[model samples]
Target: MDLSQEEPADWWEVEALYDLCFAPGRTALSSYRLRDDVPPVAQLCLCLWDESDALAGVIRYWPIRVGGQSALLLGPVAVHPTRQGEGLAGLLIRESLKRARAAGWARVMLVGDYPYYRRFGFEKLEGVQMPPPTNPDRVLGLSLTPGAWTGVSGMVTRATPQAAGHKDATDP
Candidate 1:
Protein backbone atom coordinates (compact mmCIF):
# COMPACT_ATOMS: atom_id res chain seq x y z
CA MET A 1 0.00 0.00 0.00
CA ASP A 2 1.05 3.60 -0.61
CA LEU A 3 0.24 6.54 1.62
CA SER A 4 0.57 10.18 0.56
CA GLN A 5 -1.22 13.45 -0.10
CA GLU A 6 -4.10 13.25 -2.52
CA GLU A 7 -3.83 14.12 -6.21
CA PRO A 8 -6.42 16.45 -7.75
CA ALA A 9 -7.97 13.78 -9.94
CA ASP A 10 -8.09 11.31 -7.09
CA TRP A 11 -10.96 13.22 -5.49
CA TRP A 12 -13.52 11.62 -7.77
CA GLU A 13 -12.38 8.15 -6.78
CA VAL A 14 -12.44 9.11 -3.14
CA GLU A 15 -15.98 10.38 -3.48
CA ALA A 16 -16.95 7.10 -5.06
CA LEU A 17 -15.37 5.18 -2.22
CA TYR A 18 -17.31 7.25 0.30
CA ASP A 19 -20.57 6.63 -1.50
CA LEU A 20 -20.01 2.94 -1.34
CA CYS A 21 -18.97 2.81 2.30
CA PHE A 22 -21.63 5.13 3.68
CA ALA A 23 -25.37 5.17 3.29
CA PRO A 24 -26.96 7.72 0.99
CA GLY A 25 -28.48 9.40 4.05
CA ARG A 26 -25.04 9.94 5.55
CA THR A 27 -24.77 13.61 4.53
CA ALA A 28 -28.17 14.44 6.00
CA LEU A 29 -26.66 13.95 9.44
CA SER A 30 -26.63 17.09 11.57
CA SER A 31 -22.87 17.61 11.31
CA TYR A 32 -23.14 18.03 7.55
CA ARG A 33 -25.55 20.91 7.86
CA LEU A 34 -22.72 23.11 9.10
CA ARG A 35 -20.68 22.34 6.00
CA ASP A 36 -23.40 23.43 3.59
CA ASP A 37 -21.61 26.70 2.80
CA VAL A 38 -18.04 25.76 3.59
CA PRO A 39 -15.42 24.26 1.35
CA PRO A 40 -13.01 21.69 2.74
CA VAL A 41 -9.54 22.68 4.02
CA ALA A 42 -7.55 21.09 1.21
CA GLN A 43 -4.13 20.91 2.79
CA LEU A 44 -4.87 18.21 5.36
CA CYS A 45 -6.34 15.68 2.97
CA LEU A 46 -4.69 12.27 2.60
CA CYS A 47 -5.42 9.29 0.36
CA LEU A 48 -4.19 5.72 0.42
CA TRP A 49 -3.47 3.65 -2.67
CA ASP A 50 -2.87 -0.03 -3.24
CA GLU A 51 -0.10 -1.45 -5.38
CA SER A 52 -2.28 -1.16 -8.47
CA ASP A 53 -2.98 2.51 -7.67
CA ALA A 54 -6.63 1.90 -6.81
CA LEU A 55 -7.89 4.22 -4.10
CA ALA A 56 -7.97 2.30 -0.82
CA GLY A 57 -8.85 4.99 1.68
CA VAL A 58 -9.34 8.76 1.97
CA ILE A 59 -9.60 11.51 4.59
CA ARG A 60 -10.21 15.25 4.45
CA TYR A 61 -10.54 18.22 6.79
CA TRP A 62 -12.61 21.39 6.74
CA PRO A 63 -12.17 24.73 8.48
CA ILE A 64 -14.85 25.72 10.95
CA ARG A 65 -15.39 27.84 14.06
CA VAL A 66 -16.57 26.29 17.29
CA GLY A 67 -18.54 29.11 18.80
CA GLY A 68 -15.68 31.56 18.03
CA GLN A 69 -12.72 29.20 18.21
CA SER A 70 -11.12 28.30 14.88
CA ALA A 71 -10.54 24.57 14.41
CA LEU A 72 -10.25 21.92 11.74
CA LEU A 73 -13.14 19.48 11.24
CA LEU A 74 -11.94 16.06 10.12
CA GLY A 75 -14.36 13.78 8.43
CA PRO A 76 -15.63 11.49 5.63
CA VAL A 77 -12.75 9.07 6.08
CA ALA A 78 -13.52 5.97 4.01
CA VAL A 79 -11.71 2.80 3.06
CA HIS A 80 -12.71 0.44 0.32
CA PRO A 81 -14.37 -2.68 1.74
CA THR A 82 -11.89 -4.93 0.06
CA ARG A 83 -9.05 -3.22 1.89
CA GLN A 84 -10.56 -3.09 5.35
CA GLY A 85 -8.42 -4.01 8.42
CA GLU A 86 -5.14 -3.33 6.68
CA GLY A 87 -4.44 -0.11 8.62
CA LEU A 88 -4.99 2.16 5.63
CA ALA A 89 -7.56 4.23 7.49
CA GLY A 90 -5.18 4.83 10.36
CA LEU A 91 -2.38 5.69 8.01
CA LEU A 92 -4.47 8.27 6.19
CA ILE A 93 -5.56 9.80 9.49
CA ARG A 94 -2.04 9.95 10.93
CA GLU A 95 -0.56 11.53 7.81
CA SER A 96 -3.38 14.04 7.35
CA LEU A 97 -3.16 15.11 10.99
CA LYS A 98 0.58 15.54 10.69
CA ARG A 99 -0.01 17.80 7.71
CA ALA A 100 -2.64 19.74 9.64
CA ARG A 101 -0.23 20.42 12.50
CA ALA A 102 2.63 21.32 10.18
CA ALA A 103 0.38 23.91 8.55
CA GLY A 104 -0.12 25.61 11.96
CA TRP A 105 -3.60 24.41 12.79
CA ALA A 106 -3.84 24.10 16.57
CA ARG A 107 -6.98 22.01 16.88
CA VAL A 108 -9.29 19.52 15.14
CA MET A 109 -12.74 18.12 15.87
CA LEU A 110 -14.92 15.39 14.45
CA VAL A 111 -18.21 13.55 14.83
CA GLY A 112 -17.15 9.94 15.22
CA ASP A 113 -16.83 7.01 17.55
CA TYR A 114 -14.72 7.93 20.59
CA PRO A 115 -12.95 4.60 20.78
CA TYR A 116 -11.38 4.84 17.31
CA TYR A 117 -10.49 8.53 17.42
CA ARG A 118 -9.09 8.43 20.93
CA ARG A 119 -5.96 6.84 19.55
CA PHE A 120 -5.31 10.14 17.76
CA GLY A 121 -5.72 12.30 20.87
CA PHE A 122 -9.33 13.24 20.17
CA GLU A 123 -11.52 13.43 23.25
CA LYS A 124 -15.07 14.49 23.93
CA LEU A 125 -15.48 18.21 23.23
CA GLU A 126 -16.90 19.68 26.40
CA GLY A 127 -17.89 23.14 25.20
CA VAL A 128 -18.10 22.62 21.46
CA GLN A 129 -21.44 21.94 19.83
CA MET A 130 -22.61 20.60 16.49
CA PRO A 131 -25.90 21.07 14.67
CA PRO A 132 -29.02 19.34 16.00
CA PRO A 133 -29.63 15.57 15.89
CA THR A 134 -25.98 14.92 16.66
CA ASN A 135 -25.23 13.12 19.91
CA PRO A 136 -22.80 15.08 22.08
CA ASP A 137 -20.90 11.97 23.07
CA ARG A 138 -19.77 11.40 19.52
CA VAL A 139 -18.39 14.89 19.13
CA LEU A 140 -14.64 14.65 19.72
CA GLY A 141 -11.65 16.97 19.52
CA LEU A 142 -7.84 17.01 19.55
CA SER A 143 -5.35 19.76 20.24
CA LEU A 144 -2.34 19.75 17.96
CA THR A 145 -0.67 22.13 20.36
CA PRO A 146 -0.65 21.20 24.03
CA GLY A 147 -3.58 22.77 25.90
CA ALA A 148 -4.75 24.35 22.65
CA TRP A 149 -8.33 23.45 23.46
CA THR A 150 -8.31 25.20 26.78
CA GLY A 151 -11.03 27.86 27.02
CA VAL A 152 -12.24 27.01 23.52
CA SER A 153 -15.98 26.61 23.65
CA GLY A 154 -19.10 27.32 21.62
CA MET A 155 -21.28 26.12 18.72
CA VAL A 156 -19.24 25.02 15.73
CA THR A 157 -20.02 26.81 12.50
CA ARG A 158 -18.52 27.27 9.07
CA ALA A 159 -15.47 29.48 8.98
CA THR A 160 -15.99 33.19 8.46
CA PRO A 161 -16.40 34.52 4.92
CA GLN A 162 -12.81 35.77 4.87
CA ALA A 163 -11.09 32.50 5.83
CA ALA A 164 -13.33 30.46 3.55
CA GLY A 165 -11.22 31.35 0.54
CA HIS A 166 -7.84 31.06 2.21
CA LYS A 167 -6.20 27.76 1.24
CA ASP A 168 -2.44 27.26 1.59
CA ALA A 169 -2.02 23.59 0.68
CA THR A 170 -3.29 20.99 -1.74
CA ASP A 171 -2.68 17.39 -2.75
CA PRO A 172 -0.11 16.79 -5.42
Candidate 2:
Protein backbone atom coordinates (compact mmCIF):
# COMPACT_ATOMS: atom_id res chain seq x y z
CA MET A 1 0.00 0.00 0.00
CA ASP A 2 1.04 3.57 -0.69
CA LEU A 3 0.39 6.55 1.54
CA SER A 4 -0.18 10.12 0.45
CA GLN A 5 -1.47 13.38 1.79
CA GLU A 6 -5.10 13.71 0.90
CA GLU A 7 -5.82 16.32 -1.74
CA PRO A 8 -9.08 18.14 -2.40
CA ALA A 9 -9.51 16.05 -5.51
CA ASP A 10 -9.75 12.92 -3.39
CA TRP A 11 -12.83 14.13 -1.49
CA TRP A 12 -15.49 12.02 -3.13
CA GLU A 13 -13.44 8.87 -3.17
CA VAL A 14 -12.57 9.32 0.48
CA GLU A 15 -16.17 10.04 1.36
CA ALA A 16 -17.25 6.92 -0.45
CA LEU A 17 -14.74 4.87 1.47
CA TYR A 18 -16.02 6.36 4.70
CA ASP A 19 -19.60 5.56 3.78
CA LEU A 20 -18.72 2.00 2.99
CA CYS A 21 -16.83 1.54 6.24
CA PHE A 22 -19.01 3.53 8.63
CA ALA A 23 -22.31 3.33 6.80
CA PRO A 24 -24.46 6.29 5.66
CA GLY A 25 -25.61 7.49 9.10
CA ARG A 26 -22.13 8.39 10.23
CA THR A 27 -22.86 12.08 9.80
CA ALA A 28 -25.34 11.98 12.65
CA LEU A 29 -22.70 11.13 15.19
CA SER A 30 -21.67 13.74 17.74
CA SER A 31 -18.18 13.96 16.31
CA TYR A 32 -19.71 15.13 13.06
CA ARG A 33 -21.38 17.90 15.02
CA LEU A 34 -17.98 19.27 15.96
CA ARG A 35 -16.98 19.22 12.30
CA ASP A 36 -20.31 20.51 11.03
CA ASP A 37 -19.00 23.78 9.64
CA VAL A 38 -15.33 23.40 10.45
CA PRO A 39 -12.63 22.75 7.92
CA PRO A 40 -10.21 19.90 8.47
CA VAL A 41 -6.48 20.47 8.81
CA ALA A 42 -5.52 19.75 5.22
CA GLN A 43 -2.00 18.68 5.98
CA LEU A 44 -3.19 16.12 8.48
CA CYS A 45 -5.69 14.44 6.19
CA LEU A 46 -4.24 11.27 4.69
CA CYS A 47 -5.19 8.59 2.21
CA LEU A 48 -3.80 5.16 1.50
CA TRP A 49 -4.00 3.25 -1.75
CA ASP A 50 -3.30 -0.32 -2.77
CA GLU A 51 -0.91 -1.40 -5.50
CA SER A 52 -3.79 -1.15 -7.96
CA ASP A 53 -4.29 2.50 -6.90
CA ALA A 54 -7.66 1.86 -5.33
CA LEU A 55 -8.19 3.84 -2.19
CA ALA A 56 -7.50 1.60 0.82
CA GLY A 57 -8.26 3.94 3.69
CA VAL A 58 -8.61 7.54 4.80
CA ILE A 59 -8.29 9.75 7.92
CA ARG A 60 -9.08 13.36 8.78
CA TYR A 61 -8.59 15.90 11.54
CA TRP A 62 -10.52 19.09 12.19
CA PRO A 63 -9.65 22.10 14.27
CA ILE A 64 -11.40 22.69 17.59
CA ARG A 65 -10.72 24.55 20.80
CA VAL A 66 -10.54 23.01 24.23
CA GLY A 67 -10.85 25.88 26.70
CA GLY A 68 -9.44 28.29 24.12
CA GLN A 69 -6.42 26.14 23.36
CA SER A 70 -6.06 25.16 19.72
CA ALA A 71 -6.19 21.43 19.11
CA LEU A 72 -6.92 18.92 16.37
CA LEU A 73 -10.00 16.73 16.53
CA LEU A 74 -9.07 13.41 14.99
CA GLY A 75 -11.75 11.24 13.61
CA PRO A 76 -13.66 9.30 10.98
CA VAL A 77 -10.68 7.20 10.05
CA ALA A 78 -11.90 4.32 7.94
CA VAL A 79 -10.23 1.40 6.22
CA HIS A 80 -11.75 -0.43 3.29
CA PRO A 81 -13.30 -3.79 4.21
CA THR A 82 -10.67 -5.54 2.20
CA ARG A 83 -7.97 -3.66 4.04
CA GLN A 84 -9.26 -4.37 7.54
CA GLY A 85 -6.78 -6.04 9.94
CA GLU A 86 -3.89 -4.93 7.72
CA GLY A 87 -3.02 -1.94 9.95
CA LEU A 88 -3.90 0.71 7.33
CA ALA A 89 -5.88 2.55 9.97
CA GLY A 90 -3.02 2.42 12.40
CA LEU A 91 -0.63 3.61 9.71
CA LEU A 92 -2.85 6.59 8.98
CA ILE A 93 -3.16 7.39 12.69
CA ARG A 94 0.57 7.29 13.32
CA GLU A 95 1.46 9.25 10.21
CA SER A 96 -1.12 11.97 10.83
CA LEU A 97 -0.12 12.35 14.49
CA LYS A 98 3.50 12.69 13.50
CA ARG A 99 2.64 15.37 10.97
CA ALA A 100 0.41 17.16 13.45
CA ARG A 101 3.16 17.32 16.03
CA ALA A 102 5.63 18.57 13.46
CA ALA A 103 3.14 21.23 12.42
CA GLY A 104 3.04 22.63 15.99
CA TRP A 105 -0.34 21.38 17.10
CA ALA A 106 -0.30 21.11 20.90
CA ARG A 107 -2.84 18.37 21.31
CA VAL A 108 -5.19 15.95 19.52
CA MET A 109 -8.47 14.45 20.67
CA LEU A 110 -10.79 11.74 19.46
CA VAL A 111 -13.87 9.77 20.47
CA GLY A 112 -12.88 6.16 20.15
CA ASP A 113 -12.31 2.91 21.94
CA TYR A 114 -9.69 3.16 24.65
CA PRO A 115 -8.01 -0.14 23.93
CA TYR A 116 -7.40 0.73 20.31
CA TYR A 117 -6.22 4.31 20.78
CA ARG A 118 -4.27 3.77 24.00
CA ARG A 119 -1.32 2.42 22.04
CA PHE A 120 -1.06 5.80 20.34
CA GLY A 121 -0.76 7.63 23.68
CA PHE A 122 -4.36 8.80 23.83
CA GLU A 123 -5.68 8.93 27.39
CA LYS A 124 -9.06 9.65 28.82
CA LEU A 125 -9.78 13.36 28.86
CA GLU A 126 -11.45 13.70 32.22
CA GLY A 127 -12.80 17.21 31.89
CA VAL A 128 -13.30 17.75 28.17
CA GLN A 129 -16.74 17.22 26.76
CA MET A 130 -18.32 16.75 23.34
CA PRO A 131 -21.95 17.49 22.50
CA PRO A 132 -24.83 15.30 23.68
CA PRO A 133 -25.38 11.60 23.00
CA THR A 134 -21.66 10.90 22.89
CA ASN A 135 -20.30 8.52 25.49
CA PRO A 136 -17.93 10.61 27.54
CA ASP A 137 -15.79 7.58 28.24
CA ARG A 138 -14.79 7.51 24.61
CA VAL A 139 -13.30 10.99 24.79
CA LEU A 140 -9.53 10.62 24.57
CA GLY A 141 -6.62 12.97 24.04
CA LEU A 142 -2.88 12.97 23.40
CA SER A 143 -0.40 15.73 24.04
CA LEU A 144 1.88 16.51 21.15
CA THR A 145 3.85 18.95 23.21
CA PRO A 146 5.10 18.02 26.67
CA GLY A 147 2.31 18.57 29.20
CA ALA A 148 0.13 20.11 26.51
CA TRP A 149 -2.98 18.45 27.83
CA THR A 150 -2.38 19.60 31.34
CA GLY A 151 -5.01 22.04 32.58
CA VAL A 152 -6.68 21.91 29.16
CA SER A 153 -10.28 21.18 29.97
CA GLY A 154 -13.65 22.57 29.02
CA MET A 155 -16.47 22.25 26.55
CA VAL A 156 -14.97 21.47 23.15
CA THR A 157 -16.16 24.25 20.90
CA ARG A 158 -15.59 24.97 17.24
CA ALA A 159 -12.51 27.04 16.64
CA THR A 160 -13.19 30.70 16.04
CA PRO A 161 -13.80 31.71 12.43
CA GLN A 162 -10.92 34.14 12.62
CA ALA A 163 -8.59 31.35 13.71
CA ALA A 164 -9.47 29.17 10.75
CA GLY A 165 -9.71 32.24 8.47
CA HIS A 166 -12.94 31.09 6.88
CA LYS A 167 -16.66 31.44 7.44
CA ASP A 168 -18.47 28.45 8.87
CA ALA A 169 -22.02 27.52 7.90
CA THR A 170 -23.33 29.27 11.00
CA ASP A 171 -21.77 32.53 9.92
CA PRO A 172 -24.23 35.01 8.60
Candidate 3:
Protein backbone atom coordinates (compact mmCIF):
# COMPACT_ATOMS: atom_id res chain seq x y z
CA MET A 1 0.00 0.00 0.00
CA ASP A 2 1.04 3.59 -0.56
CA LEU A 3 0.36 6.61 1.62
CA SER A 4 -0.25 9.88 -0.19
CA GLN A 5 -1.86 13.26 0.18
CA GLU A 6 -5.55 13.12 -0.65
CA GLU A 7 -6.83 15.01 -3.64
CA PRO A 8 -10.26 16.54 -4.14
CA ALA A 9 -11.18 13.71 -6.48
CA ASP A 10 -10.66 11.41 -3.56
CA TRP A 11 -13.17 13.25 -1.39
CA TRP A 12 -16.25 11.44 -2.64
CA GLU A 13 -14.56 8.07 -2.45
CA VAL A 14 -13.28 8.88 0.98
CA GLU A 15 -16.76 9.82 2.09
CA ALA A 16 -18.11 6.55 0.69
CA LEU A 17 -15.36 4.61 2.38
CA TYR A 18 -16.18 6.25 5.68
CA ASP A 19 -19.84 5.49 5.20
CA LEU A 20 -19.16 1.84 4.59
CA CYS A 21 -16.67 1.53 7.41
CA PHE A 22 -18.76 3.26 10.03
CA ALA A 23 -22.29 2.59 11.17
CA PRO A 24 -25.21 4.11 9.29
CA GLY A 25 -25.92 6.80 11.89
CA ARG A 26 -22.29 7.65 12.44
CA THR A 27 -22.56 11.26 11.29
CA ALA A 28 -25.24 12.09 13.82
CA LEU A 29 -23.10 11.25 16.83
CA SER A 30 -22.38 14.08 19.22
CA SER A 31 -18.70 14.01 18.40
CA TYR A 32 -19.55 14.43 14.74
CA ARG A 33 -21.78 17.44 15.46
CA LEU A 34 -18.66 19.62 15.34
CA ARG A 35 -17.69 18.32 11.93
CA ASP A 36 -20.80 19.53 10.13
CA ASP A 37 -19.76 23.17 10.52
CA VAL A 38 -15.99 23.04 10.01
CA PRO A 39 -13.88 22.39 6.99
CA PRO A 40 -11.31 19.64 7.05
CA VAL A 41 -7.71 20.50 7.91
CA ALA A 42 -6.57 19.94 4.35
CA GLN A 43 -2.90 19.73 5.23
CA LEU A 44 -3.45 16.89 7.63
CA CYS A 45 -5.80 14.64 5.67
CA LEU A 46 -4.08 11.44 4.52
CA CYS A 47 -5.10 8.48 2.38
CA LEU A 48 -3.75 4.97 2.01
CA TRP A 49 -3.95 3.26 -1.36
CA ASP A 50 -3.64 -0.31 -2.45
CA GLU A 51 -1.88 -1.57 -5.58
CA SER A 52 -4.98 -1.02 -7.70
CA ASP A 53 -5.33 2.58 -6.47
CA ALA A 54 -8.35 1.89 -4.30
CA LEU A 55 -8.57 3.91 -1.11
CA ALA A 56 -7.87 1.61 1.81
CA GLY A 57 -7.89 4.04 4.67
CA VAL A 58 -8.44 7.71 5.47
CA ILE A 59 -7.93 10.26 8.28
CA ARG A 60 -8.93 13.91 8.54
CA TYR A 61 -8.50 16.90 10.85
CA TRP A 62 -10.45 20.12 11.39
CA PRO A 63 -9.70 23.50 12.96
CA ILE A 64 -11.14 23.95 16.44
CA ARG A 65 -10.75 26.09 19.54
CA VAL A 66 -10.47 25.03 23.16
CA GLY A 67 -11.11 27.90 25.55
CA GLY A 68 -10.37 30.10 22.55
CA GLN A 69 -7.01 28.36 21.90
CA SER A 70 -6.35 27.11 18.39
CA ALA A 71 -6.06 23.37 17.92
CA LEU A 72 -6.68 20.70 15.30
CA LEU A 73 -9.38 18.12 15.79
CA LEU A 74 -8.54 14.63 14.52
CA GLY A 75 -11.27 12.24 13.75
CA PRO A 76 -13.19 9.61 11.71
CA VAL A 77 -10.15 7.55 10.85
CA ALA A 78 -11.62 4.80 8.67
CA VAL A 79 -9.94 1.68 7.37
CA HIS A 80 -11.45 -0.40 4.61
CA PRO A 81 -12.91 -3.57 6.03
CA THR A 82 -10.64 -5.75 3.94
CA ARG A 83 -7.48 -3.96 5.05
CA GLN A 84 -7.91 -3.91 8.80
CA GLY A 85 -4.84 -4.44 11.09
CA GLU A 86 -2.22 -3.57 8.48
CA GLY A 87 -1.23 -0.45 10.43
CA LEU A 88 -2.47 2.05 7.84
CA ALA A 89 -4.46 3.97 10.43
CA GLY A 90 -1.49 4.42 12.70
CA LEU A 91 0.68 5.44 9.76
CA LEU A 92 -1.82 8.11 8.76
CA ILE A 93 -1.96 9.46 12.31
CA ARG A 94 1.83 9.73 12.51
CA GLU A 95 2.28 11.25 9.08
CA SER A 96 -0.56 13.74 9.51
CA LEU A 97 0.67 14.88 12.92
CA LYS A 98 4.17 15.30 11.46
CA ARG A 99 2.73 17.51 8.72
CA ALA A 100 0.60 19.45 11.21
CA ARG A 101 3.65 20.18 13.36
CA ALA A 102 5.75 21.13 10.39
CA ALA A 103 3.00 23.53 9.33
CA GLY A 104 3.22 25.21 12.80
CA TRP A 105 0.14 23.73 14.48
CA ALA A 106 0.90 23.21 18.15
CA ARG A 107 -1.92 20.95 19.26
CA VAL A 108 -4.43 18.27 18.16
CA MET A 109 -7.31 16.65 19.96
CA LEU A 110 -9.56 13.66 19.32
CA VAL A 111 -12.44 11.70 20.78
CA GLY A 112 -11.04 8.18 20.77
CA ASP A 113 -9.75 5.30 22.75
CA TYR A 114 -7.04 6.36 25.19
CA PRO A 115 -5.05 3.12 24.92
CA TYR A 116 -4.55 3.33 21.15
CA TYR A 117 -4.04 7.10 20.83
CA ARG A 118 -1.63 7.32 23.77
CA ARG A 119 1.03 5.73 21.58
CA PHE A 120 0.90 8.83 19.42
CA GLY A 121 1.65 11.18 22.37
CA PHE A 122 -2.06 11.87 23.08
CA GLU A 123 -3.13 12.11 26.70
CA LYS A 124 -6.23 12.97 28.66
CA LEU A 125 -7.06 16.59 27.94
CA GLU A 126 -7.75 18.07 31.35
CA GLY A 127 -8.65 21.47 29.98
CA VAL A 128 -10.43 20.59 26.77
CA GLN A 129 -14.13 19.90 26.42
CA MET A 130 -16.07 18.57 23.48
CA PRO A 131 -19.68 19.48 22.65
CA PRO A 132 -22.24 18.16 25.08
CA PRO A 133 -23.25 14.48 25.07
CA THR A 134 -19.65 13.33 24.45
CA ASN A 135 -18.06 10.84 26.80
CA PRO A 136 -15.29 12.40 28.87
CA ASP A 137 -13.06 9.37 28.74
CA ARG A 138 -12.97 9.44 24.97
CA VAL A 139 -11.78 13.05 24.85
CA LEU A 140 -8.01 13.09 24.39
CA GLY A 141 -5.34 15.46 23.11
CA LEU A 142 -1.64 15.90 22.29
CA SER A 143 0.86 18.70 21.96
CA LEU A 144 3.14 19.11 19.00
CA THR A 145 5.00 21.84 20.88
CA PRO A 146 5.92 21.97 24.54
CA GLY A 147 2.91 22.52 26.79
CA ALA A 148 0.75 23.31 23.82
CA TRP A 149 -2.35 22.42 25.77
CA THR A 150 -1.44 24.41 28.84
CA GLY A 151 -4.23 26.68 30.04
CA VAL A 152 -6.34 25.82 26.97
CA SER A 153 -9.76 25.40 28.50
CA GLY A 154 -13.46 25.82 27.75
CA MET A 155 -15.79 24.16 25.19
CA VAL A 156 -14.38 22.98 21.91
CA THR A 157 -15.72 25.23 19.16
CA ARG A 158 -15.03 25.51 15.45
CA ALA A 159 -12.64 28.18 14.17
CA THR A 160 -13.11 29.16 10.54
CA PRO A 161 -9.84 30.63 9.25
CA GLN A 162 -9.56 32.36 5.90
CA ALA A 163 -6.22 30.69 5.15
CA ALA A 164 -7.99 27.38 5.57
CA GLY A 165 -9.04 27.64 1.93
CA HIS A 166 -5.42 27.54 0.75
CA LYS A 167 -4.12 24.29 -0.65
CA ASP A 168 -1.99 21.88 1.30
CA ALA A 169 -0.63 18.41 0.51
CA THR A 170 -4.08 16.90 0.69
CA ASP A 171 -5.58 19.29 -1.81
CA PRO A 172 -5.93 18.57 -5.48
CA lDDT of every candidate: 0.81, 0.86, 0.82
Question: What stretches of model 1 exceed 4 Å from their correct place?
Answer: 167-172
> Higher-lDDT candidate among 1 and 2?
2
Misplaced by over 4 Å in model 2 are 166-172
Question: For model 3, where is the 10-residue window of minimal lDDT?
Answer: 163-172
Tens-digit lDDT string for candidate 2 (26-142): 999878877866677788889998999999999998888888777889988999998899888989999999988888788889999999999999999999988888899999999
Clashing pairs in 1: 67-155
* Residue 148 alpha-carbon offset, candidate 3, angstroms: 0.4
Estimate, for each residue in 72-122, the C-alpha lDDT of model 1 and write its tens digit: 888889999998988888888888888888888888899999999998888
What is candidate 1's local distance difference test score? Answer: 0.81
Residue 13's lDDT in candidate 3: 97
Off by over 4 Å in 3: 161-172
- Residue 157 displacement (Å), model 1: 0.5
| Cα deviation of 91, candidate 2, in Å | 0.8
Q: How high is each candidate's TM-score?
A: 0.91, 0.93, 0.91
Estimate candidate 2's alpha-carbon lDDT, on a 0 to 1 scale.
0.86
